[model samples]
Target: MKTTCKSLLLYVLIASVAVNAFDPFTATFVVGVGAALGRWIYEYSQEKCDSKWIAFNATGLETDLERRLFGQHIASRIILKAVTGFMKNDNPKKPLVLSLHGWTGTGKNFVSQMIAENIYKEGMESSFVHVFTSELHFPHPSQLETYKTQLQQWVKGNVTNCAQSMFIFDEMDKMHPGLIDSIKPYLDYYDKLDGVSYRKAIFIFLSNAGGESITQTALDFWSAGRDREEIELRDLEVALSLSVFNNKKSGLWHTSLIDKNLVDFFVPFLPLEHKHVVLCALAEMEAKGLQRNLDVADRVARDLVYFPKPERVFSVKGCKTIDSKLDYYT
Candidate 1:
């Protein structure tokens, strides 16, 4: 009885001290910390439960991809089909892979930006849309192993978080050997692993490997007085694929993505002519909220150098330098 009374007295004393020590300031601090912690927990739960899959506006995207993306009808069509198919597919065995071969300034990067904008909720800034540049990301040949490990981890981590992801690889022709092959596992036909499925993802490769042949083909058509549109997918697909495969300098060379036919599409970006540059300039002007000025566009187009020496057939840099050249005209 005496020991029990002493224990009760000790409990009462501790309770009194706690109450006294908790002043108004202490109470407010405690409440503030608790509220902050609660908010943090709630936000974390929301993020975890949130669905990263963004709903694509098919009709709107198709129109924008076609309209905003100038001069590449074949590429636009293939991109549309791939995006639509992947989004609608309930079961996919492998990821949609595309090899975009063209010279610089043919809108390869622009098309990629368009895809991200339409497909991803956050657009190019989305965590799901990852862009890897050979020159920027992995330039050294010795870094191939490191790059492979990093690439695999990145793919696995993102797919685990969200199945719908887009990966754009730029300067593929400058990439180190075996680096491009690192993604074969994620791209190949496979079942889900650890609840992660990469089949819903998209992979785009941009390269200038076959720029010479593409330019030659375009020039040949111009010389023959044939319409540029006369050069179709059939005329370039096989040749471009072969050129990328055969060239040792190409990133796709010796990579099974091309040899094993894992690449879903080989979309060639044709060289932009004077007319396309003018269109680009006009588009730029419009984007700046300025009225359509054909005179300014013509002047911009004239300022750019053209090829075939004497004939001065086409815009040498395509629409690559049009944006900067427009500043002077404006």
Candidate 2:
């Protein structure tokens, strides 16, 4: 009877040990599943956050410009927010510099990633200078009218009682001629025309408009009814005799038909000193191998730093234009 009882006790102990041994395997399986699920959730959350940030920050950038210029930079959205803050503020007057990129480039290319990165590092809410770019495609006549109306509404809504704003229109040559007329209302009112002190806005129109048709138009403006041959000859002479920074060379005089009643056209040529600074900046960028093309290097450099010494003179013998400067830098 005693022996039988002891055997039974041993059997029960063995069964208990076997049950305990399986607990570790069960626990390990549960832990593995939990870890995997946690990792997947964290990754998904991060991706969602990044997408939201990008969309929130790039509110006003033209889609094409954003895709082409800021596609690589991670901090573009941040820089844009800083710029928007500056635009909204009314205190401590600062010029609103608008950069218009030429054909085949986005504003981001002209502004450069380095510059945008630097702007982001400065932190948001700090009052930095403001710069904007109208990199959207040239609008049709109807589109231009629509844009004008929308812009007017925006100003009325956001900039109440504001006295002045600076405006820059880049690639003016690419825009429909009628669009130019649509903007006249803004310019005229800002300049305090008709004895009213509305706003003080300085308008800058930058374009490559010295082509045959443009030149002929200038000739026609001066003297109508001339043969195409005579107009072409006069246009050629006018184009050649005009100073490098002259309106004729820069194609700013085309605004006469659009806004003749407004202030006399003011097309300040970028100074030679500024040109040299641009060249030096490009050279520095090239030394760093940021870009291979001289034009690209110069543009990137300008985006990084404005002409530090606007008064420092540089010769124009070989660096006659921005294009020439780009060639030398390259």
Q: Candidate 1, 58: how far from true, in Å?
A: 1.8
Question: What lDDT would each prediction earn against the true structure?
Answer: 0.79, 0.38
* lDDT top scorer: 1
Question: Model 2: which residue pairs collide?
Answer: 294-330
Per-model clash counts, in order, read 0, 1
Q: lDDT tens digits, residues 1-330, model 1?
A: 346545555655455456546988876665565556556554543423134436676786798776777777777888888778776787887998888888888888988888778777677878788899987889778777998998889888988877887889999888886787887878888887666778888899999888888778877878888988788877776678678998887788898887678898888888877778889999999988989899999899888888776877766677898878888778
Candidate 1, superposed: residue stretches over 4 Å from native = 1-53
The digit string of per-residue lDDT tens for model 2 on 1-330 reads 346545544554454455555588765655555556556555543422122222222343434235333211222343344445543454423333322212221122244333333333222211221222334744444576676566555433322333333344556555554454444555443433343333433344445443333333433533555433233333343443242224433333455433344533222122122344455445444555656455564563353322223522222221323444454545
Model 1 worst lDDT window (10 residues): 44-53
Following a full C-alpha superposition, what root-mean-square deviation does model 2 have from the true structure?
19.3
- What TM-score do all the candidates reach, one by one? 0.83, 0.33
